[model samples]
Target: MDHDNILETNGLNHWFGAGEVRKQALFDINLTLKRGSFTVLMGPSGSGKTTVLTLVGCLRAVQEGSVTLLDRQLNGATEAELVALRRRLGFIFQAHNLHESLTATQNVMMGLQVHRGVSDAKAQTAARHALDLVGLSDRVSYLPANLSGGQKQRVAVARALVGNPALVLADEPTAALDKDSAAEVVDLLKRMGAERGTTTLLVTHDNRILDRADCILTLEDGRIVRVDDRH
Candidate 1:
């Protein structure tokens, strides 16, 4: 219940399917992420790294154990409550899932549309500012097809951050970019966390991100086996 912790999980467990086919994907997981901190979840394939992120991000239900996200218990939260909680979270995936028909600004505006009471003018202004923050002021009118891979990812970052969510969940954000572009995206996230106090929990296999993380947790066989604290 501490105000300083953005996310906390105690004895968290997850299972997929049901009946005889039910299979456990996560064991008891205990994790705490402080506000404004940048953390990375790293592990091999099928290691339950994505499971943990989805649980905290409200993308999936917590089967067993407790998960407190943004100070609310997700164990038995209603669907409406989950929808509201999801509005307060920003998610970035390996693929920059921007609408092909929408321009960069229009795509970023989609992020602000989830929050109630945001006028079109306000959304446009915020989108411009967000794109500017990501160093894409000139590309606001550009479509996703016209942009490079890195530019597309930056637009995704801008969209995720435009809402000013309390937490950001990123999964392999830099996977498709080149080395330099990948570094730029990671650095931008770290800088944004410091400036806006936006806690970030990223699941990535990129080693380049480890150096920028305040904490690095390694998951193996559904359990946390190592925690490297750089804070």
Candidate 2:
């Protein structure tokens, strides 16, 4: 693992089932994500893009080899340690996953609630700041139903960023938006990366936003086949 990398995977392999019926989702995956860099992982459906995102987010346990975040080994981390590690990594899924019942501010505040002793006032302050950073300050009180697709996604991003995470993982963030809205979200992400010094890894099939990525990686058949760095 590279000492300067925010994320590193070595001989990583994930499989389902056993014997002849076994299926491999990722195989011999070795990669590193530099600190404060914006990287995109692009691939067709079922190409292990989401699998890699999930593994990095600590949503899935490593079945083989090693995975590390901020130099801490993830494959051997305890449940409590995994929770702590996840708190330092923000994740945005294809679905905005916002609580329909909660307002945008409340939804963003949810992330801070996971911290051991964050006060309500402090959480609200952080949530407000996050929403403002995403250009959603005016929609803080709006529920998901009242917001546009882009707004909902922005709220999700705010929720993710509210924790002040060291790394941000986004899965198909712009897939549900129109071209203008998608570009807006991409710009927001880029600006966030630059302003906060957060390492961002975005997984997407959306070709339109690829140009905004500092580094682009292509995965196929559960393997990373290409990497292009424009910066």
Candidate 3:
């Protein structure tokens, strides 16, 4: 029951496959993400960075050890429980994943639709506010097909944050953007963390954004090898 931490993993180990062909993926991984803090996970490919992210993000089931997210333990949690927990998280992937048929506001409204009681009008209001926060207020009615690469990513960011999720999990979110766009997206995420108290755990290989992280964790061969805490 650590109230200050939004995520905690203790002795976390993961394996792929079963029987004689089984292979271990993650070691005894242990980490903690404090509320409103921004953390970056960086490592070489196949070093278990994404594995850790997926586990803590509730996209994958925990095989061994404990993973506590938002004051609830993930180990042995039912599918229904996991689904409920996932609604509280915001996820941003490398791909923008916008529906071509939808406008920016409509796309963002999709994020809030997962909740039980939000109406379309209210969702649209929240989505517009989120787009405004991400500097996309003018593009609310624009379709994703008409937007630039960076603008599409901004729409993705707005979609993720519209729900007011407690934690935001990003996997290479800036990979597809240009230099300036990447910086802008990262800066927007940092501002959101500062202003909204949204905790973020991002997995990135882009070194340009490392300087902005409050804590940077480096993994190697499925083990956490370095932790650089700027704060």
TM-score for each predicted model, relative to the true structure: 0.98, 0.96, 0.98
Q: How does residue 78 of candidate 3 score in lDDT? A: 94
Question: Where is the poorest 10-residue window by lDDT in model 3?
Answer: 188-197
Q: Which model is ahead, 2 or 3, in terms of lDDT?
A: 3
CA-lDDT, candidates in order? 0.94, 0.89, 0.94
Where model 3 places Cα greater than 4 Å from the true spot, the runs are none
**C-alpha lDDT (0 to 100) for residue 210 of candidate 1:** 82
User: For model 2, which pairs clash?
Assistant: none
Native-to-model Cα distance after best TM-score fit, residue 149 in candidate 1, in Å: 0.3
Tens-digit lDDT track for model 3 on 1-231? 579899999999999999999999999999999889999999999999899989998999999999999989999999999999999999999999999999999999999877999988899899999999999989999999899999999999999999999999999999889989999988988888888889999999999899889999999999999999999
Clashing pairs for model 1 are none
What overall lDDT, based on C-alpha atoms, would model 1 receive against the true structure? Answer: 0.94
Q: Write the per-residue lDDT of candidate 1 for residues 1-231, one digit (tens) a residue.
A: 799998999999999999999999999999999998999999999999998988898889888999998889999999898999999999999999999999999999999988999999999999999999999999999999999999999999999999999999999999999999999998898988899999999999999768899999999999999999997
